[model samples]
Target: MQDKPENLSREYILPDGRSVTVGDQLFRAPEALFAPREVEAQGPGVVGMVLRSLARCSSRIQLDILRNVVLSGGSTLFQGFKERLLKDLQAAIPSIAPVKIFSPENRILTAFRNMWITREDYYEVGEHKVKDI
Candidate 1:
């Protein structure tokens, strides 16, 4: 018989046969919006929208660990992005600590950055407080 192809959908049936979905996850990152500037223009007010969506997400997620949300990738390159995103998420969801957006000065070497993080211990320690974290 030919090899069967696995379904690529986000939804799936678990061992007990109940269907599970990753659920309606909403990203507060401006990049997720087509016209991100619109939200940015309004500033922290948009966090209300994002928080409402997140609250409705399926409870299957372990929220304790979920509080520390990280945003990587090219699209998060807006100026003052991390500060803005955190302010909004915090205002709307008081329980959610903050949103951390990682931005490298040189966007071209994201892959290299990932490799560097993996081998971070091999590199010499620096006085940078962020690096200490």
Candidate 2:
């Protein structure tokens, strides 16, 4: 993995004239997405969720699924997020599966254009139905 210079600590002054220093927390905060326990959350992280979802599908389609993974949304815009996910998935799954992640340059916009869901629709159908989209 390439080291990120942006991870360096920097000081910022708030509108009220108070100074605050930010450091590795920016990077560490995102780690919770991969290891939820670090933030005292229950259940598996994103990769585990993907694996569990795959397990529910028929074995014949597992390979197809792994080869066409698409990542969308603002959270996925974090630096190195896609590469890290691909690496983790490759490590967790069988070698022959050949994990691939497709992250468009404008993922959020792409999602909005192709997969936008209304608040009412989401509430009506719930998470399980939304996942199938």
Per-residue lDDT tens digits for candidate 1, residues 1-133, read 6432232225778999999764323233444443346555543234555556567777665364246555555555554556777766655554544444445566645545644543365344543533654
**lDDT tens digits, residue span 18-37, model 2:** 99998887777778899989
Query: Which ranges of candidate 2 are over 4 A from the true structure?
Result: 1-7, 10-21, 114-133
- Poorest 10 consecutive residues by lDDT, candidate 1: 23-32
Candidate 2 residue 72 C-alpha distance from true site, Å: 0.6
* Best-performing candidate as measured by TM-score: 2
lDDT of 2 at 43: 83
The superposed Cα distance between candidate 1 and the true structure at residue 76, in angstroms, equals 0.8
Candidate 1 structure, TM-score to reference: 0.34
> Candidate 2 local accuracy as lDDT?
0.87
Candidate 2: clashing residue pairs, number: 0
